[model samples]
Target: MALSWALASGAQSVTSGHRTLFVTLSIVVTLVTLGITLWSRHSTHTTGQFYTGGREFFAMQNGLALSGDFMSAASVLGITGSMSLYGFDGFLYAIGFLVGWVVFLLLIAEPMRNTGRFTLADTLSLRLRERPIRTAAAVANLTTVIFYLLAQMVGAGALVAVLLGSSGGGTKDVVILILGALMIVYVVLGGMKGITWVAITKTVLLLVVAAIATVLLLDQFGWNLSHLLGTAASKSPQGKAFLSPGLEYGKTVASRVDFVSQAMALGFGLAGLPHCLMRVYTVPTARTARKSVGWAIGMMGGFYLMTLVLGFGAAALVGPATIKASDPTGNTALILLAQAVGGRPGSLGSTVMLGIFACVAFISILAVVASLTLAASSSLAHDLYAAVIRKGKATELEELWAARYASIGIGAVAVLLSLLAQKMNVAFLVSLAIAMAGSSLVPTMLFALFWRRFTTKGAVWATYGGLIVSVTLVLFSPVVSGSPDAMFPGVDFQWFPLGNPGIVSIPLGFLFGWIGTLLSDERPDPAKFAEQEVRALTGAGAY
Candidate 1:
């Protein structure tokens, strides 16, 4: 009922003229992205350029692209909306995300840059059994990337719901299909070069729009944060409690544990995200990868700080009641805030503000969808098809065709799944994907890089074991079937109390890897371990 009401409310809030403006902006942005893709296509004939942009991007260029890839619509629109409704608890997402980027830089990026050729599987298959190791890595990669794709598409669906404004289901489905088609073209025609530039373009626009919104918001309050906070608190339903941590996650012991688990997921998950790992190989040297991450951190940090102000600004200007009435999940908080900040409903400023923010959000979603699809298709071609099926005999032309077709297939699957699961909570799907990554990929990569005695069995175990446990736990948890906000609230099949399984699944992934290593009869390759260590640390003999 809340979901239906939220959708209907959101539909009613959008005016017909504003809806036309959104479509106009989307078309303009799509044409621009297509032009960028065409310009980059000539350079992407080889697999290296298709996958890593030929390792030629400077730190600043790649940094902005990294920021583009990392800062999804989920983080910008969703997190600001989250903070608008949940206050301090929602602020935790920014902290966890920033900290996770730092963790990836310090622990994951340099080693990956120094080691992998194409995919995350390349890094794991360094010394392990190529077939089984690549297979397992591909499975984990597809699992995480697909879930992320679904999350982004769901956000796209919500945007459609808002734009259509009470239109019939057929119209909304067409919009989603158009979106899917655009995403397929981005990956198939442009590849990494196009995707990188698309990301760079959208990231700049998103940051600029966000910064303007933040400055205008602050100006309304005389540049005094205290006044903003005071107004937000006074207008919020929870009042003073809205300024504290307990409003969202502190009501019960189980909820508190789930909050901690979620924090764990975000903190470690970014280190293991397949798409982020792929970004490392786009830089020439490990030092460049590190420097690029540094640049990303600085830019993303500025963006998150702006979100804090915007989140509060939304609450102060739009109020909790209007926000919840429009969208129960708070996804529309930014939109409503934009409308409010732009002056009267029929004014030109209002229309322009809505158009700019909506356009950037639309572009951001498409870019993220394309990136995820590319990651999955690349893994399918390079890891499973070339390595496992062809035994590494496939030519570059065959591999490229495989990747292009795979992108179309994966994009279709994601679009279909998004339509099917349109009623599911977008936040739940994203959290589950990250938790799975934290549990499965993190342990496998950590051991592969540092453990001298780690074996092929251990890597396989860690990857499959972590993924299986995370999904199983969530299936039986409140997030899936039991709670009011669950995907299937009509039933009560939940056995686990916590919403997130990260705290348990992550440790077990490591333990299972260790145990699997000890139980295997296979001997550890000390020579390979030594080479890996040298390459990971000193960039000597690195690909």
Candidate 2:
């Protein structure tokens, strides 16, 4: 909600020791990142290496990297806070996020690996008119990437401020700048290889930290899962309602609709996240790609399960009123929980645990931003500059250089936007990002892979129509101007009711694809479609 937040109730103050430990741990993390980047930078000597990690990563390696990309600090804070605040309904995000991988594994992973080289646009260009398809996909890619980048950057700033126990205004801005600069350095120097290693490392650290916290929390409740829930129900303001569905989304018809919209966004949107999907290309084979997704699913699934303990644990330990007072979004809940479970609030044990979470959170933000920046720059360089601007005449070296330069440009834009929108609803922006990803990419990519009748016009319409409608709807929706938490609280132009546009825009993506294909005079080529089908299914003639 607001950028200005006090420490959580239990954490009335951060000890000097705690702040020093956090700074030290953070410095160690930064150095580790640079070390990885330096090594990876040396490894990246070709266009293939820069864009796809030279396709040498094993299944588990790429999978953990993929997990690193998907699990942002914003997501961890938001989901855990939601779990603490809304109980069961908040767990829906974890469910939706994990289930999206099923769609990816079944429908996208193998095909994407077989068809794409560096970006999704490459897969579409095989059958569609290369220019329009690539341009539309690139635009959608950049738009989605920017939103995700902003969400992560803003969350990073806020979380950093919270960890340091500083007032947000200037402190948050400074963190955003520093994070942006580090992200630029990571992508410009290390590229995909560097980003992959960073993500792998981040994921491991997150799992370890989360596991330790869960064990400590369970021990606090005598290792009884049922006891924890009972205690959480006892402590929450809503009492027993905290364990039920209606507490959050079932309260009203509009709220119910928002629930469905949210489910759609998390499920399909995560599946279609451009950056996440492109990681499949980094693995060596389609089988490895599929296995990597399986690995990602398992890893994230375990992590989501852990959120249950942390979330309800916090609710049981740190009261909702205290959490809301500190930060309305429930972010302070996690830090407060860290403090509470580690030991007495403000004590050495509690603050040390809090400091550790801060370190992992900082790395989580860095890992995600680097990956998104890589995807954004790769789309701009490979799809737009080399393919569109130079008409495929650009050499490998020129394209590689273009990607590095594009990373800086993209990082600059993200930093500037994050600073401008720091006070806006970061959660709302994140939802819109996921919704737009689903609407813009899901239908287009699915049709290109499965539907024999799919054409360039269909791809173009699906990408542009879904992208425009979802964004336009959100612009007029409560997120932008009507409700108390709206981006512009002083305005009241909201006409749309749903907070997430996924339910409406997602189906429209498919409908627009069908409509555009029928409207186009250009006939689908059977030979090319045959080629694509064989290549997609059997991995024949794949790059």
Candidate 3:
């Protein structure tokens, strides 16, 4: 009876029955994914296939995969958890994320698809000198990918540990390692084809589960949205504050500025992310890429809308105290909500619901980590190794093998770092990753795509300089020290006031690009700009 009550309040650990079911479903999904990988070997033999899924996917398939890649543990779990605890402030994330996609659809997607060969570096190198620009872009790609990967790994390991009721430090490490190895297998063996299938499959499952849970939640409130919000506000300890913006970040001028900076990062950073940009290259043509982005925005917008309900549902049903008790970050709110809605603990319905959520969460982690690993490995092989190191002389076979090895290496490093970083907050890392991307990649991409006078020196300076400033600021920021959410709580050396560096670093990136170009003696190359514009607009020589 206590277990049954705990389900409604989300105050206790998962039941043993649910854990068993969760483990079983996890195994089934893992085996199925591995089978898909094996089957994909036929298409992955060529470099184009391995890197871009042979550029064969149509608009809808690529759109679903794009949605899958964008909707990570952070988007589903982190944002919902924020909503459950912070209410109106949390919905700001949904708005910011959606706005970022508008940037991609209007500016980045079509041209990126038309110009790039395999990676983001390929596009940057089109107008600039090959070696320096490629190397700089590769560094920017790896920095963003590794940070994003570490956050995902930590969240996955923690979520799996909670589902299985395992608390030992070694068990957490082992979970991270296995998850890393599983993702590496998806990238190394299956490449883009296998990864795309997994993304599309998992994203649909995640959306379905969310939709079902939302419907059940609506049923409890007589299908009235206002009633749900009212119940959530009454149940929350913050009361009316839970329905307003001040609960999370509106307390002081400084806090508001930091919030704005974070919002900027979320709004502009999606266009700059290497993994998201790489998705554009998978479509058959520029027109298909634009259509795919439109589809992805629709799906993602619907999902975020559903999260508002799920967030309120968790607040009204499970309460914030229990959510924090399960995980301080409130990432387990949806899992608890799933069990509560299904039935009382130990019931057949509860067991089935718990099993479904376990599989969903596992697949969410797998899809995101696989994309990140692929992105990082592509930078190493296609950009750094083949272009910079081998002077564009390496054979396709050689580059492909290099990519596989790079995936394993990157996974291993991420697993170890994630294990060490278990105490850090996943949400903070996600925001940091976005801010880094906005600071480094956004400026360079805009200048290269639109400005004729943008030189190699300017591009390199923006990439490397923006990266250094962002990383250095993060190292000294409050997220790393001096507060309750600090990664190293005992340390107090925080100097940067803002939690995110986008507001400051992004402008610096653009300024560095402009200043570098002005100082460089390299003559303006209008012809190169014309050629790139022609290719980007007309889709010539894209394949």
- TM-scores for all candidates: the values are 0.97, 0.97, 0.96
Lowest-scoring 10 consecutive residues by lDDT in candidate 2? 1-10
For residues 1-543, what per-residue lDDT tens digits would candidate 2 score against the true structure? Answer: 112222333234567777888999999999998999999988887889999989999999999999999988765677788888889888888888887999999999999989888899989998899999999999999999998888888878776776676764799899999999999999989999999999999999999999999999999989999999988898888999888887888989999998899888888998788779889999889999999999999999999899978999989888787678777867778888888999997688887898999899889989999999999999999999999999999999999999999999999999999999887677677877888999989899999999998889999999999999999999999888888878888989999998888889999999999999999899888999899889989999988
> lDDT tens string, model 1, 227-310?
999999999988988888877788998879878887888898888888888889898899999999999999999999999999
Worst 10 residues of 3 by lDDT: 1-10
User: Candidate 2's error at 542, in angstroms?
Assistant: 1.0
Compose the digit string of candidate 3's lDDT tens values, residues 1-543.
000001112324578888889889888988988899889878898779989999999999999999999888677777787788889787888888889999999999988888898988888888798999998998899989988888888877777776777665676788898999899999989999999999998889989988998888899889999998998899888888888878878988888998888778888788888889889989899999999999999999999999999998989888888787776667777787787778886788877887787778788889989999999999999999988899989999999999999999999999889989887766567777887898889999989999999999999899888888888888888878998777778889999988888888888989999999898888867888999999999999887
Clashes of 2: 0
Ranking by lDDT: 2, 1, 3
Error of 3 at 188 (Å): 1.4
lDDT of each: 0.86, 0.88, 0.85
